[model samples]
Target: MTTALTLTTGQDQDGAPVLVAAGEIDMSNAERFTAALSEAITDRREPLVVDLTAVEYLDSAGLAALFHHADRIEVVTGPLLSPLLAVSGLADLTTVRTR
Candidate 1:
């Protein structure tokens, strides 16, 4: 069975676009995540902040989706964040800010 990734979009305190991604992001749902992000960027031509605090896991396909839009994406995570990116060796490909 294919799992679905849920993405919630909203604005931050400064009114910047923010996307909250929860659940697992793997081969099963990387394409859906990418499509949602693409739609968000197309709707708002500004930098997008992605909150990964609730993400439990991420795979190579998910990392690729994030890196594909790294130029305009910012990753935010809480303390004790998952080391999915590190395991995938994509820690240098994207900006991950700890909160």
Candidate 2:
């Protein structure tokens, strides 16, 4: 079965666009994740903050989605997912912080 995921849009303290995601991001829902990122990026036209602290799993497809939008986004994830982001080389392309 496909894993559960939720994507919510909002603004940060500085009024920058933010996309808060919860649950797993795998091939089953990677497309939806990418679409959300695309929408946030297109609508805001600025660096979007992606909050993934509550996400439990992210597969290669999810990573690919992030890479596709690497230039226009920052990532905030928990320690569990930090190493994956760093090892995926996404940390080099954009800002990724662990919380």
Candidate 3:
């Protein structure tokens, strides 16, 4: 079964566009994640803030989707997923803020 993923669009304290994601992000829901990323960046020039602080898991498919948008996005993640992002080399490609 597909893991539950929720995507919500909002602004950060600094008024940057933020996409808050919660739940597991695997092959089953990676497409939806990609779509959300696309929508978040539409007509926007500044880097999109992807708040994955509440996300519990992220698989290869999800990581691929993130890689596609690395140049145009910044990531905010919790401690649990910080190592994964670093190990995946995403931390080198963009700004990753751990909270």
The Cα local distance difference test for each model comes to: 0.78, 0.94, 0.94
User: Candidate 2: what lDDT?
Assistant: 0.94
Compose the digit string of candidate 2's lDDT tens values, residues 49-94. Answer: 9999999999999999999999999999999999999999999999
Clash tally for model 3 = 0
TM-score, model 1 to reference? 0.80
CA deviation > 4 Å runs, candidate 3: 1-3
The positional error of residue 32 in candidate 1, measured at the CA in angstroms, is: 0.6
What is residue 61's positional error in candidate 3, in angstroms? 0.5
- Using lDDT as the yardstick, the better of models 1 and 2 is 2
Residue-wise C-alpha lDDT for candidate 1, range 1-99, written one tens digit per residue: 444578999889988888899888898888889998887663556688889888877778888888888888888976645465555545576677877
Give candidates' CA RMSD values in order: 2.7, 1.5, 1.4
Q: Cα deviation in Å at residue 46, candidate 2?
A: 3.6
* Candidate 3 Cα lDDT to native: 0.94
